[model samples]
Target: MENILHSPINNNTLSDFISAKDYTVSGNEFSIKIDEQTGLLITTPRPKAEDLGKYYESDDYISHTDGNKSLFEKIYNWIRNYSLKKKLALVESKHPKGALLDIGCGTGAFLSVCKQAGWKVKGVEPGAKASALAKEKVQESIYPSLFDAELNGQKFDVITMWHVLEHMPDLNATIERLKELLTPTGVLIIAVPNYNSYDALHYGKYWAAYDVPRHLYHFSQQSVKQLFGNHEFELKETKPMIFDSFYVSLLSEQNKCGRKKWFSAFLMGLESNIKAQQTGEYSSLIYILNRK
Candidate 1:
């Protein structure tokens, strides 16, 4: 099955140039094609794998993977202070209290923050090592896969997908399922890399956010809103999560041309910060959405 959809443009600034193409995998529907012009995924209900290896245990953290108490402490502190702050802000703004779910909750960083803030938290993660680490760090029950987890008929006030939505092959179905799991006034928080950001334009295919086959879909702000709109969700607010630009750009610059460009990476990091403050279209974005 195939569907061709209009490309998503940035607030009608540029002509639509991207096209979206949907495909299927093992009887599950998913999108695999993205038009560079409009930056939209054509398919709606696509199939995706639930494999955990695709996201957990990066090469950078392999050395500190185990028995590195000091290293883990440092990492925990950094994430707790920074990443968790942004995530909490989103949750506090919308839900304030009640149960919360974090899909693809790597390392349970955000969950720790939520727990500290007194919100009941649960998560679904596929990565074994990461899930184990998360279990140790947060002490909360985490399901290995969202599809396999039984919610015990419990509903949540908020569902978060930080940088996890793009990895999904069945974007539409996933959204629908999340809707069913939500309370009538529940909110869903989604954060993903924005392909239409200035950094993406500057870096082109070298953009780090385009993590190849792993990032099944590249979404722009407009495209994401449209996706949610079709699924009976309302776009409550959108904000650029600027920190990822520097982090992703650093990785991209280091891996540029198969060589680590430390200096170039530093420059990219600086550039990302400047662009984020000025334009509010950083390399990544957080979307706060509510069911209609």
Candidate 2:
């Protein structure tokens, strides 16, 4: 029943290095092991879900925020929403107006947008507060967990797990479930951080995306393609999330050097994007996949 693989990258919780008052400040140490052949990085001795209690419910989980936001927060949200709209446009282009399911649908932001765009939408969120917030936004019930029996027989044209696949420990089981939930011609969109990106190499172990035990898997482009290929998924397209380089680099700067060097981080992000543009190794990648 062991799901873990080989090789390792030592990392710590963001709170351990960054002076962030918003997030729960636990500096617990952990190592992420890599499977050289598969290019998969696994957090060694995965921390139990319960042991990582309430980490998602912290002040840092801004998706669950209610009411008006600060100017900065609003700007950030605008950027995120704009990015999501573009992402949805890509998905819609492939499978125009079909039943869509968003896994890890926090606050139902994307779900709400999809609904407005005329797609039948459903969401699954594991976080209590986030689920409640999502329910308020979407007409459909937001299931609290991925294992809920309600999703057993349901099928969808699109199943998206944005930046969520890495959080899962049961790789084989998760892939199987995604396949089962897809319609005959369905698409599965999985977005994950790329450990092979220049920013990752720049930040090294201090890469903020390596959120220790919470992010059980650190997937490179090769590893992601390998994981899906192993499970009979044909990667249709590889889309880059351009903003992630800036966001992750800023966080990595904060985490690695114990300060927010915005200019330096911006330069690093720009460089990362340049490298990714030339080499196709983005900081974060959206893999559009279909059953082979």
Candidate 3:
């Protein structure tokens, strides 16, 4: 484990933020710290990259798992289905249909949608079951890791990481590599949860988005801009993933009481979104960037 004293995005001192629990797998508590410079939150004594896989070995980790018997899982699937088209539209609105790369493209659902719209797509998913399922959706090869995805010097016009950036262990190296893989005029879209959001502050340590340990980094708007901007990626736009607030709050409600509370979660989600409209700080934000 690396007991980091400085923020990866900026070499600034870190201060204690809160102690969060791993409600998904273990009840073990983990401490979180914030980058005094960029406001990014990080889990100290972070699990090594090799050992991180074990944390995700659960049926509840929706993105990697296939099980959907539970009602929450069913809602997750429906939201995913509806969001696929919205994702496609967001990509098309950014740039003309060209080569696209979706890191952590679980099950290749978004890629399949892009392919159906006449755009070439490729995916990278490290999970065994999810990668295998992804292969069924898109005929194109699904690489196990971004490092292993050799493209014969090909570059993508658009690259997306939906709710995926926080899990990456090699944050700085990943951004450098993303730059290498993009075309000169390509667009990069990344979506991550905001610790500055209303729900996050309200739930404090119990915020479900802070799925401690597994989510290695917690990004604030300043952190996102500073980290990527340091690598010369210009911020293009910021959009909200409104539905995420509801979903995350639902899980958070369960985390607090160990049982589902749909109504209260919905109210919290709505209140969070409403408050976000005034603050421009959505629970989850999609940041689009380009080389500068």
Candidate 4:
């Protein structure tokens, strides 16, 4: 598997990788060339943590929650949060009242829900402001980084990384660390966008999920399974993050059409979901894994 070669897929820019020093950012500069081999779209020369941190400096780090959102934004967020909570509830149903660890737990939304559900919850968030806000909802202080968590001796019953695995720089190291942190019976949940989804095919480069620089790897079902299997993990089940199609479609439409096309986006999203149901390919998917 280490010898697998990735052929060029596409070149991508950072959407805003400009600086005064370099008036011209080349494809090799701030942009990444996505390469594909065995269904995995790998970003070349994974961006450094320091380089990536600048992009998430603002409140919009965790999707559209910048400031006082508009009525529509508020409504949209409620729907998204409700869907997320439902998914977490499913996790809770399986491992009731167990210790849970959420990596890259942005603002502690899920942690808040898990706490209320009687789960001993802890979170690791890299952002300063978001971690501070998360601390308000969770009694445990969130670690600034995964390494700082010092979870070596601590075992958790459940570990979750929602849309975070793709951003990791070292896939092998991260997976190994996750395995070490989990109890013998612990389950690992990872959610990521699928490059093989219909929406990805429709938007191509403008696909919101490509999210270059920030999202270093684009994973398909096959790729995800292979990666996990290589690290001694087995897939237990997979669930679709249904609402993600609509949200991703809306963002893709904005990127492609250069404006809001809510109606068109909704129609595309519906079509995408329908196709996914028939093919088991979703815009975003939640994968449940356990040590093999």
Candidate 5:
């Protein structure tokens, strides 16, 4: 198990070092590469958190309620509206009804929804407080670490990593382990920010989705597909979560220069939505993949 890095282009930056086609690190059956174009790290076999501090930033984590009341209300309404559509789509899809696992199930909001839908739900989360909150909300056991969690040999019919993959230290290994945990014909759903989206083009590094350090890997559709294809997974479907671009852009603008730029944030969000609707390149995309 050697971690090998590969990139089509090379430079002196760490991003370049990781992305160099010849660069590879070996330890636990994983390799990480940096994409020079996007400045994102890609890994074969996901990385593990030796200590919580490396990944967890208290200030960055948003509560269920945080931003302005209007913005909060709008976001909640959007989430609620989209959740129904997403849940319906999931139910109608080929996904099985057996056990489901949600990796990095933040606050367990999605799990709670799934539970109400009558699916057997379980999760893995790293944040202690968020994990506790998820437990309270879903009343299901949540492992604090994906590396240490016991799967109990129960294969899952559906595994979701909503907005979680970019945060993974070793992306490939995580997906590999997930493949092992999935039942035959099982589906893995992943949602991540799309660096190729129009918002990214306009915002550059200011793009809200690149919640840097926390978002170690900013993936484009091509990169994500390539990552999964190299492994044994086949992409079943790819679609953008259009609204996220607007919301995330707002947050990103607020974080820029250490103060909230309300007008600029709103304008960027508006522009993101317009472009997302016109083109399918939303700020984020949700991919449904099946094991090949």
Candidate 6:
């Protein structure tokens, strides 16, 4: 939902990474290129930010719809509440509970949980349907974008972006905005799928985490650090989202075989975690950061 892609990359900075189909949207194939400098994967021919909305206008876009019509969705809804608690616990462990800002807060479920736990919470969601639903649970203003939030020189103690950064069109600009909104002592928590994880290698292009144009950039632990490191953010710690491996592998199997290879997917998920134990690279990672 950013004004996106005034990339600083040159031809020498890019190399072919992989070719993937937009499984969630257009069904067209897209090339994922690696920025040799940052180790961040960029989608070639990335859709214009203004034209990106239509791609999300699908019933299949799971985040926007809480549809339990399929087994995939049912399992998602079940684990979500538990994951919400776990996410809160992780944040609280690192920072004192106070004002929090959730960027790209889909459905407001996470903020709702935090609000109930006595934290002042606000959300920024560009999706109209999602922002409307989030308003039902979060009492404070739900701004369509950070620019509209109008904090009036106020700053949040903690800010979070759960699997949201990869979708950002203007990465540097977004980071600058975040820095301005955060209190000097505040923390920034970012959760994103790791391209270097074992699951990614196992599934390759079938990796459901590589959700194409929507995920314009794919990150590794190194790439993530480099991004914020360039913007003067300190990397505090990293946590694993263990459930993500199994969930991602589930969809990956379907994409690979055109059917749900439940048993195979389970094996892959298990293998990925086991390997991550040795490599310190999990299927998904939550980076804890603060102003440097």
Clash count for each candidate, listed in order shown: 13, 3, 0, 0, 15, 1
- Which ranges of candidate 4 are over 4 A from the true structure? 1-37, 62-68
Tens digit per residue, CA lDDT, model 3, 200-259: 988888899999888999999999999999999999899999998999899899999888
Identify the candidate with maximal TM-score. Answer: 3
Error of 5 at 214 (Å): 1.2
Report the Cα lDDT for residue 57, model 2.
47
TM-score-sorted candidate list, best first: 3, 6, 2, 4, 5, 1
After superposition, candidate 3 runs with Cα above 4 Å error: none
So what's the TM-score on candidate 3?
0.98
- Cα lDDT of model 6 by residue, 58-96, tens digit: 887667766778887887888998999999998798788
- So what's the TM-score on candidate 2? 0.89
List pairs with backbone clashes in candidate 3.
none
* Model 5 C-alpha lDDT per residue in residues 1-292, reported as the tens digit of each score: 2233453223224332222111111212223446755455554323344542443545345532223356556565667557746854674476646688888887777787788877899989878778898899999989887666577576888888888888776666787788878897888888898766776777655555655444556687777777787688899888777667667766666545555576776777678767777777778888889888
Query: Each prediction's TM-score against the native?
Result: 0.77, 0.89, 0.98, 0.86, 0.78, 0.94
Best by lDDT: 3
lDDT of model 6 at position 108:
91
Worst 10 residues of 1 by lDDT: 20-29
Candidate 3 C-alpha RMSD relative to the actual structure: 1.1
lDDT of each: 0.68, 0.78, 0.91, 0.74, 0.67, 0.86
Q: How would you encode candidate 4's per-residue C-alpha lDDT over 8-66 as one tens digit per residue?
A: 22222222211111111222322333333446666655446667776454443443232
The TM-score that candidate 1 achieves is 0.77
